[model samples]
Target: MTRKHIDCRSFPSEINCSIAISADTDRELLEAAVQHAVAVHGHHDTPELRNQLRGAIMDGPPTEEQPAR
Candidate 1:
């Protein structure tokens, strides 16, 4: 199965978070990304936010180096 990833640095945020999360499935990646967003980025948990996070997910292993954001 292909791994999925969500790179925080790829998104535009005030904090410019550099954290990246990866998982075996889109569901798992979304869950971890949501937790990181809430705990570290101070974003509130909401359906809309969840949808947005889901949309941001990418296909591949998490990269060690940050891509151009």
Candidate 2:
């Protein structure tokens, strides 16, 4: 299966985050994304946030060109 990842540049953020979180498994990716969201994005870890992060996961790595925000 394709690797999963969450790229900060994939979404529009006030901070214009450029980080990308990737893992071989969904559990690992979600946890890492949660930590980054909490630590760097100053977001509280909530079920809703988790759902949002889960939804943001993509089937591949970050692209050289970010999608238009």
Worst 10 residues of 1 by lDDT: 60-69
Tens-digit lDDT track for model 1 on 1-69? Answer: 998898998888888788888999888888899999999989999999999988888888878887655
Please, what are the lDDT tens digits per residue for candidate 2 over residues 3-51? 8898888777799999988898889999999999899988999999999
Model 2 misplaced regions, further than 4 Å: none
For this target, which candidate reaches the highest lDDT against the unseen true structure? 1
Q: Report lDDT (CA) for all predictions.
A: 0.87, 0.87
Q: In candidate 1, which residue pairs get closer than 3 Å at backbone N, Cα or C atoms, i.e. clash?
A: none
In model 2, the Cα lDDT at residue 62 comes to: 66
